[model samples]
Target: MTSRRTFLFKTLPAAGITLALARHVLAADPELAESDPDAMKLAYAADASKVDKTRNPTWATGQRCDTCELFNAPDGGDLGACSLFKGKMVRAAGWCNQYVP
Candidate 1:
């Protein structure tokens, strides 16, 4: 008969490995950018209020990439989709006073 200690020793490594792999599998996929429009809209709204001096100091001065309603992030980049324009991408580096988040 197998000893309890031996069984635990054999199973512990497997369990640890399984948990590690599960963490990797469950981690957020970097490829899933701008997958949800509603979430992105909310995010934009949240960041919009902040003044981006680097881009624009005032609402009239700066233009947010997402706020322009024409900015769209590329499929795999940190950028987001624009509501006004279609099939175009915007830069995360770009900013405007209209930025929500």
Candidate 2:
């Protein structure tokens, strides 16, 4: 018969540990690069400077993956995961044809 205090004490740390591990797992390293075939298919560039503004007139000078709807920045880092390229991280300053603002 564990008391409520004991239950909480045991549960809280385990829950905290699980949450920490989940974050770590979600922050795993990227599996693809801008030069990959799939990335090339989308015309993804690791640096926004490399994007052809003439072709992507809708892309503004300051637009970046960090601001894109598909990006999932990890701890607000400069490099984070993008839904466009699963299991792969993209630079915050990156751009692509698939960018949605």
Task: Output the number of the lDDT-best candidate.
Answer: 2
For model 1, residues 1-80, the per-residue Cα lDDT tens digits are 99999999999999999999999777633322233473354333223446434544455434456445556555545556
- Cα lDDT tens digits, model 2, 1-101, are 99999999989999999999999988788656867998889888888888888877767787788889999886898888888787788888898888887
Prediction 1 TM-score vs. true: 0.34
Error of 2 at 24 (Å): 6.2
lDDT of each: 0.50, 0.84
Clashes of each: 15, 0
Where model 2 places Cα greater than 4 Å from the true spot, the runs are 1-27
